[model samples]
Target: MSGAAGGALAGKRVMVPETRELEVLARMLERHGAEALRCPLVAIIDAPDPAPIEAWLRRFIATPPDDLILLTGEGLSRLQGVAQRAGIEDGFLAALRGVRRIVRGPKPQARLRAVGLGADLSAAEPTTAGVIETLRAEDLHGRRVGVQLYPDNPNAALLDFLRGAGAMPDPILPYAYASKEDDARVLAMLEDMAAGRVDLAVFTSTPQVRRLSQLAVPDRLRAALAATRIAAVGPVVGQALEAAGARVAVMPEDSFHMKPMVNAILAAIGTPGSGEAA
Candidate 1:
């Protein structure tokens, strides 16, 4: 969609943390006439070791699980890339076709479609709790469930729930977060927020919040965040921000993607007494 000259976000400065779709988000914000303040916070990279991932793929091909839980589209894509490089893409896809695919959100569902597949079940709310709630009614006793996990998050709650339900939880990590080398950039962004230079700070992932909390002192981070309005892409990210001691001022009511998030920003800014820049 073309942004109007008098767009809703005209003259707004929105802080966007680094993510796989950084440019996509930045362009979307800029299209609406907002200045996207790009800050590098976290980087995603292929798993440092591929042997375990290949082993998991081989095992999966040998004995297709009864259910598969895909958390992020990135994890699935990374696994597919590894399978392709190992000359086992066909086997992997074939095995995948035999399983009941469960997805946490729309991203994994979209990735499934990319591979000529679809989700058999989707979480009701796109969060870990949502996934558990969706599967609460399923007969998981002694069932083999393969879970695709992202970097740094162990997701103990999901695993424990699966075990409690008598399912064999097989988890794999296909990607990892890069080391924190962008501390300076994050610090600069924090500085900008503290100085009231940023109109809104947008976060799309939990890791970004963690990174910011890690680099800045707690009181300082909270103080800096208080200077700007915070928008989280969804409830999960919103919870993380809150847990980190920042108040979330904007979030989409239904959808949690970037486009919906932009609309939320617009809606918040257009509201009377929303504290947006004049």
Candidate 2:
């Protein structure tokens, strides 16, 4: 059910709410015969106040922690950039290498590998639950753990779990979500969904779902979701869509990446199923 070659999603209008990979995602859909709607709801930006990250780096350099948890590749890259900006990139990387590294997913793991470092532990499912379960088996008692954070989603559960395991969790939020106030564009997209102009809505991150929900009235968003099928990139995004009262109709079976997500979307479109209840 390839979107190209007049595949399942051929000529279908799909909404894409992503900033980081907007062009790639949209173009991928367009190649498959989808009129990809680009509506970026949130922008990923470096934290306005770099003090926290700066301080964390200073502490990391001074006293390396027992475990370093990397959540997102972007966060790791941002950390590297911050370190480079501070003229301590070499020291920062060295300090990170001194500690045991645990990665939440493949992204962070890849980032580490790109820098000639490797993760001691990697989450199997690449989610917060996976991270917690993986850490649950480890001996974290009286250990200091530094965590690199992603934007918008505050992983309180992971932190609480660490604390419960007698580990000191120090999280560094490397980025923050800045709202994209293109009301005209967003409203038009929402209206298109409500009018049944859009056939699918693709969400790559949870923050996009939250920001979209906040921008439009709940009832309107709910109605639009009811009319159109929704596709999430992975379990995390799917859960977010569900929480926002959007029925997630498609997701990848494994490997929650853009290619897999596009394939899953096409498959779902080809073989329509009884989508999850709204």
Candidate 3:
């Protein structure tokens, strides 16, 4: 999908709830002449204790699971950091290279590329169900599988599926979400949206949607979301927003990424010259 041209979104007020690439998303909107309301909802941090992560890395290096499922780019990146800090970066990378890497989405693929690696299998839908579907065709009986997980979710579904398929799943959570600190800011942003100040509210991760839902009452949250246009980065995020009683007005049909999401946003709210809602 093509991105919006410079000045396309002039006078538009787009609320961004991203954390990791808050500036990047803001600049993308700014480049399109939109005012970016930066309200980061969650902060990604390393696991509070590194001992468990270090142990996982050591076990991974020693055994080298036959299959490694990467759920998020941040998870892989965090694992890499933990491995480096433990002075086992090479061993970790070597073990990673030995396994067949399966990615849930393009982000994980991008992360793999950063480490001079690539995904051997990619989910068709970029969701947990997609991951399960992708692995369904494989011969996983008694296979050792390493699962990279993120914060807040234990992904019992994926683990149960793996166990049902007779695969031994070893899951590792290398990072955690620090979102409690941002509750006040997120609630303020919700109030802004409720007041019809925010033209569009963009969500890039499920955690952002969850955080908003957690901070606001259901009726109030739904009312606030109804006052503004909502844009989701992918189906997963879109589903999360929908489940939270918010309608997703904009989303990329194909590539689920930042640029595609920007393009979708531009399409939903026409350019300045088109005389749409800003």
Candidate 4:
């Protein structure tokens, strides 16, 4: 906290997560004197039930396609566990061995390499637009496309677009979101926000936006969200914030991590702290 958030935030309190999962980020914020709000926005869950995914994995590995498109590192990691559990890791890799792998970014690429799969292509920009361009560039039209998707990915639109362009897109969803379950607390936070009790907000994933939207927040709170400057970790989350009408004020260029995200936020606020450029 002695750095930017600490240097400039020694007196300002910012919200950290209450779940204690974000202890690292929270401590950094606290160092800056910023109050860390510990309320969690969303909880990570395993893919819904795993039964359906097991069935899909069985079928997919039985007759693995010629291409594998990975949309997230987490999904790939989970699929590895599912594969190992089914005693089909060998079969899965055999089916995927010669197949071309398309990853959304570096993280997924690293995951694929760990599984002994080589990436044939990775989205240069890490967004839907980047995916489409990569697909087009690789002449993926009419080829079997397998996509590992996030629980709340808005890839429905991109899938539709791909099919319209004559590409066969097979999207395998690895997870589903069960609401955050802290409904009353989220509502209260929304109320406090509307009352101008909160200062800033941080969004790390797109799913958080959909989760918040499900609350049917009051018009005034929504308005306050629009007025409040938001910190986003990456393009996908930024797009989600935009969809929810939050004006994004800061973002990092590469990885969606706390350090860079906090740096971006500090710069945007012109905070005289450790991260602000001289």
TM-score of every candidate relative to the true structure: 0.94, 0.92, 0.94, 0.82
lDDT of 4 by residue, 19-73 (tens): 3246777765665556666667676667757877777678777766667878777
TM-score, candidate 4, is 0.82
Candidate 2 clashes between residue pairs 3 or more apart in a chain or in different chains: 3-32, 4-32, 11-33
Worst 10 residues of 3 by lDDT: 269-278
- Shift of residue 186 alpha carbon in model 4, Å: 1.2
Q: What is the lDDT of residue 25 in candidate 4?
A: 73
How far off is residue 210 in model 4, in Å? 1.8
lDDT for each residue of candidate 3 in 115-134, tens digit (9 for 90 to 100): 99999999988999999998
* Candidate ranking (TM-score, best to worst): 1, 3, 2, 4
Q: In candidate 4, how many clashes are counted?
A: 20
Error of 3 at 35 (Å): 0.5
The pairs that clash in candidate 1 are none
Order of quality (lDDT): 3, 1, 2, 4
Query: Cα deviation in Å at residue 230, candidate 3?
Result: 0.3
* Model 2 CA deviation exceeding 4 Å by range: 1-8, 271-278
RMSD values for the candidates in order, in angstroms, are: 3.4, 4.1, 3.5, 3.5
